[model samples]
Target: MTVSAWWFLLVGAIVTYGWRAAGVALSGRIDPNSALMRWVACVAYALLAGLIARLIVAPQGALGDTALWMRLSSAGVALLVYFIFRRSIVLGVTAGALWLMAVTTLAGG
Candidate 1:
């Protein structure tokens, strides 16, 4: 990469780390169980959910090559497996990945 690219990366890293450090410094002063904190948590979760839904509905790159139904089906199965396994993250992820691979292969992708 060019020197400019390296410079940008360094600046970006510093900025990101600065924000993280600031957050850490302020963490003790903030009320973790405050209403504002609860609202922020809810908003963060909603944003994450929206992003995941958008990706499943209109994926990009390799994921986009797979059919929407296949992705949805895999996600559904993963959720089911997660619940059935008492929310084991490992099993849930494995089930989702395996389902996606099997569906994609069987579909002749």
Candidate 2:
């Protein structure tokens, strides 16, 4: 990468860890159950949900090309399998990956 791009990466890393470092420095100084902490947790979850939504709805490359209904249905089946099988996250992820592969094959994509 160019020097400018390398500097951007370094700055991004510093900013990312700066937040963690600040949190760590403040940890125990503030109550974990405080409103600020809850709000931060909610924001974190919202970001996570947004990322998943984008992956499911907008995707990219090979994934973006998959049928939307098939993708949603595959996720649903995986979730069902996860709940029905004693809530095994590993099995759930595996089932989702397998489901997507099967759907892709069935769709001839």
Estimate TM-scores for all models: 0.75, 0.81
lDDT of 2 by residue, 23-108 (tens): 89998898989998899999999999999999988898889888998789888888988999999888988998899899899889
Q: Per-residue alpha-carbon lDDT of model 1 for 23-105, expressed as tens digits?
A: 89988898889998799899989999999998988988989988899999999989999999999989998999899999899
On lDDT, the leading prediction is 1
Model 1 scores worst on lDDT over the 10 consecutive residues at 1-10
Compared with the true structure, all predictions reach lDDT values of: 0.91, 0.90
Candidate no. 2 TM-score: 0.81
